[model samples]
Target: MKAEFVCTDCRKQFIAEGIKNEYTDPVYGPCVIYTAECPLCGGEGREYSPNQGGDDHEHGMGPSCPSGGCCPGCGGM
Candidate 1:
């Protein structure tokens, strides 16, 4: 089946399909898998399927602020 997941490194959205080997950590077993390049930074990585659709800074969530609000970590300038 096909699914939509966001890149943890880059907040860009993308679709993953044709995933044959969704298993990782043989002992732990296979889980959700991604088989596409990140749409934002073009990086290759994997994350839990549930982590999709979240704010990602490494992928450039925003330069300054999202909505005139302070950053979660740095607060504000």
Candidate 2:
């Protein structure tokens, strides 16, 4: 099955195939979940599929370097 997730912070979407449903909390009972990295933000978490194509580049998603040619937050100097 294909699983989809959307990053709330970056508003990015990603899709994954052959998702495995595994229980995270053993004590909390059976709770199947799929964990994957966000293709747009590269964040280690859930990712969702896109409703349409061409939206990926349109939103400038992903952890791409800024136009300034440097990572301001990471101090890429």
Candidate 3:
């Protein structure tokens, strides 16, 4: 699924595409989550809705450094 988010740091908006994975959260029981990184900022974006359930919750990291794409999410690995 795809969603839009505004980077808190850069104040810019971007889209993120992610794959869904389901797992047992122990406390939450069955949980479905989508994880994706912002293309423009390479930030870790996360979103979820309790009412929707099994729905898309978008998330993003932060501004990216072009040198090595090093950020909290990618770690420049």
Candidate 4:
């Protein structure tokens, strides 16, 4: 399946195909998840929900940098 993902290290966003893996989570119990790698950063990527803007911050990040990336508070841009 295809899903949106954000790199945990570099915070790059991209879409990639992944295979569903069935596993049991200690808190959520049995669950299915997709895993993929960031082609740009080669870092592990996590699925991102569309409902959550684009930034990963829970309360939202500060202003955007001149380059169109997150502010320095998030170590972005």
Candidate 5:
């Protein structure tokens, strides 16, 4: 499951393995946080989806994640 992520520093869109985090956010209650790291700049990336996240953008090439985990794809969870 390759999901798109945008780097905070470069704003580049890349596909990577997404870590699905489920926890209680206290004020927000249950929350699901997806996190990934950029392969190019080693910066943190926020999960992106073509359908809900935003419009389509160019994709970068690299391993899904540094941990080598599979990530979800576009138009999906």
Candidate 6:
């Protein structure tokens, strides 16, 4: 599967594709296994699209993170 992530630090958007491991059991656990490297800044905490395995999409720099953080506007920055 393929997924897209946006770096919160450098404000870089990229895509990640690789194997996915899903572990789910009744008494064991529901652990998801996956690894990805940032294509741009090589940084982590790249927020994934809500549908895949990350947070929701925030458009335009005019709005900040829900917690009130840096806002990378629609390429305005």
Whole-model lDDT per candidate: 0.54, 0.54, 0.53, 0.70, 0.66, 0.55
Candidate 3 local Cα displacement, residue 28, angstroms: 1.8
In model 5, state the lDDT of residue 6.
85
- Evaluated at residue 67, the lDDT of candidate 2 is 40
TM-score versus the correct structure, for each prediction: 0.37, 0.39, 0.42, 0.58, 0.53, 0.37
Across 1-77, the per-residue lDDT of candidate 3 in tens digits comes to 88654444444556677657789998989998665665667765454333232212221222334444454554544
Top candidate, metric TM-score: 4
On residues 1-77, what C-alpha lDDT tens digit does candidate 4 reach at each position? 89888777887888998657899999999998776799997888778765445554422343334334555564553
Clashing pairs in 3: 43-61, 43-62, 44-60, 44-61, 45-59, 45-60, 46-59, 47-57
Error of 4 at 40 (Å): 1.0
- Residue-wise lDDT of candidate 5 within 1-77, one digit each (tens)? 46888887777789999888789988999999787889989888888744443422212222332233234443221
For 1-77, candidate 6 gives per-residue lDDT tens digits of: 67766665665667777346677978978977554567777766343654442333343223334444344543333
lDDT of candidate 6 at residue 58, scale 0 to 100: 48
Model 1 clash pairs are 10-59, 23-30
TM-score of 4: 0.58
Give candidate 2 regions above 4 Å deviation: 18-21, 24-28, 47-77
The runs of at least 3 residues in candidate 6 whose Cα sits more than 4 Å from the true structure, single-residue gaps closed, are 19-28, 45-47, 50-77
- Name the weakest run of 10 consecutive residues (lDDT summed) in model 6: 53-62
- 1 or 4, which is superior by lDDT? 4
Clash counts for all predictions: 2, 7, 8, 0, 5, 1
State which candidate, 1 or 2, has the greater TM-score.
Answer: 2
Pitting candidate 2 against candidate 4, the one with the higher lDDT is 4
